[model samples]
Target: MSPLADRYGRRFPYLRLSVIPACNFRCTYCLPQGYHANPNAAQALTLDEIARLLRGFTVMGMHKLRITGGEPSVRHDLTYILRTAAAVPGVTKLAMTTNGSLLTRRLHEWMDAGLNAINVSVDSLDRAKFARITGHDRLDDILHGVDLALDAQMPSVKLNAVLLRDVNDNELPAWLEYLRERRVGVRFIELMQTGDNLPFFRDHHVRATALETQLLEGGWQALARVADAGPAREYRHPDYAGRIGIIAPYSKDFCSGCNRLRVTATGDLRLCLFGDFGIPLRQFLQADDQIEDLVHAIGRQIDRKEQGHFLHEGRTGITPHLASTGG
Candidate 1:
């Protein structure tokens, strides 16, 4: 494998690719009310073009590729994209992030197509409350889709529940119970700066420390760290085969092992999720730019990644929504 380290000594071997700019649901913490249905209607990359970009990334020593979206499953050709990514020479893992509404029928095919794992966005359990959070009434569909994932024997299926204060914070125990019964991993993601809906911080935020205390009280033991986990501090229950993860990007910082980079659906290279800067890789690809040139440019961009995202401490912020950058 090629040396993956950048000028700042940060290695870059993992890449998150957003195959589609469009999504099916309108989660309040994500997209805005009048957000365009097609953020890239004028410039969505074709599946073949997306494959070419992945090829470039692999040539630069990228080994792990995650497919994210505006909801990745909503894309009709998502399986094709996954297959293409898995088929890349140096790429070893192809995972996806989705809302889990559309996984009922196609999950088996996805597994067969070399999709190694999945991260489903499920915030609330109460049907009406979920609708309030996501502006969609597909909780039942999501539940069914999760079942389908376990049934399909996905290697690393994880449920991603973004905890919100007063809304779902009190329901963490209940959510853990539900997953415990099913024997699936659950990850609680602290909500960060993303869409226009995040207007204030005082009432909406819940720190990960509070959630960890609640989990311990609820009988979930903290299993020691898995080897070299990038940002998440993982724990496992005593008896259950499943585990739980806490991503505390807000209260705690994991900028040191931050080796990830994002490729927007329209093909911009986002260096850091919270930093307001990116170089347009799609523009170069569309201009028939050479692969080696693209790799060198991406290396230059990662060398410029911000030291950290200090939003609460009052710093300049990234302009694009978290969805656009593969949060």
Candidate 2:
């Protein structure tokens, strides 16, 4: 029962499980026209399958489990999934990333079901700009949802903004002001170059280094990171109550500290976010006693994991957009 590690000596203690691949938001950088169900794609994992997968991951030394989706709120049984993951003996952290559109109505349900941490996608603070990017006029409601999350004392209330060049890039000043009074952490992620977003990526992708420069100039100090933490490099400011994180995927040696693995909604174990292929796990996920085979298959497949992804070479393998793997 050794830990889940690649040949490069990196151990994975985190897993991002995509519960569903269908989202309602038409974020320009991701699903521009919203999600259309693919007739040929396998149906999303059932609740029991999810429980088995969680158990397998826990046995392999995964301490944190993130329930991701095209947007998790789109799933009717998300709360039940959360409860099942919470019931897993080795799962110390239970989190989910959402679009925040349904946070107002579902936040409490998620918490009662054992969700302690949450990340909501809030690409822009400006209502109109948010609408322009997401094709949804729900910024007001989303922001309100954030406030409710904080007031209810959710252990974590971080926000994710896919920084765009000419779009919401210069809104750092507004973001700092918002973070000044709240205890939330706002992460400005550099928009990645996906197969479908090459043109759009060219037009709007912002380098996270540029944002990091702004943060340093504003007296923000980089904080030390733990082994199991996500890829984001966090910074703190003495003058603000909240923190800021920069997820610079393009940064040099960004993949050196890779600690998380992903599973597609259909039960494919994806070694890397932009990996060339996936190992089908659904066959073993069909029965309760199949957990051993599931773990063994995972072990064999992960041995072939590359040292790092070839994203810098302009190769994004099978990922057409962030929504495909719950990025």
Candidate 3:
């Protein structure tokens, strides 16, 4: 199979697959008002369907797969899905992004099933602040989960935090101090203007570049860029064991090197995060005879991938909820 390349000649090797859209936490930045799962959960792709889609993607040169969701762990058949995905012929790596509330119980099982790495979202380390931010008091559990992932000796365990101004932004120094001795890498992501979070984003969005400046001033050295660093610019401090990364989606347009495609839990193949364009793959997958057609359709969508998202230009397209898109 030929490598999947967009119009701009960027080859895609990563696929972000959202297995579920219902989360257990209502993080203020993501789901401030909370969410209710669709009553007809049957509308979602079955475990077998997910496996088939993953196999197709791997065949198309997608070597890196990241399982995501409103919270992927909430799915009852996640283990089965992970095991199936891990067995795909061409898949080189399997990772997951979770809220970490449930990792303490399932991290070991997931690791055993071939999960290569994990990125846990933790906005605040302060117990009370965590509860207020996520509408749940699971900070201790999340921290324990991170420790467990490190203890399990996973190749890479990262903590992903969305930087919110006047919220957890002030905790950067403290968070850095906490990670100084830990082995896990931490990434600070700038809040994106997607879905209903736009209003909240407008008020709390902090430019990751600003934070990076602060880190530089504080004595962190900019590291050489990894060829496949994705959207984050990584840095390191001589005194700290862990590395730091900053994702400036809104402030810095890192689209030229974008190498990923997203598949929503319901099987929509999104060409870009800030754009509404997508191919409804769920309908095609429902028909057994549509496998060939699905493959062709996926190729078409990849070819149509936009030059870049225009959120930085203040132009909003059909931005879906971050939960639905599994950011």
Which candidate gets the maximum lDDT versus the true structure?
2
Rank order (by TM-score, best first)? 2, 3, 1
Stretches of model 2 off by over 4 angstroms after superposition: none
Per-residue lDDT tens digits for candidate 2, residues 68-90, read 98998898988899998999889
Return model 1's CA RMSD, one decimal. Answer: 2.5
Model 2, residue pairs in steric clash: none
Q: Local distance difference test, per candidate? A: 0.75, 0.92, 0.83
Candidate 3, run of 10 with poorest lDDT:
312-321
Off by over 4 Å in 1: 32-34, 38-42, 198-200, 216-230, 283-289
TM-score of every candidate relative to the true structure: 0.90, 0.98, 0.94
lDDT string, candidate 1, 73-156, tens digits: 777888888887788788887888888877887888888889987888888888988898888899999889888888767777
Ten-residue segment with the worst summed lDDT in candidate 2? Answer: 302-311
Please give the lDDT score at residue 205 for candidate 1: 76
What candidate 3 gets wrong by more than 4 Å, as runs, is 38-42, 286-291, 313-316
User: Candidate 3, residues 173-216: lDDT per residue as tens digits?
Assistant: 78888878998888898888875666787899877777888999
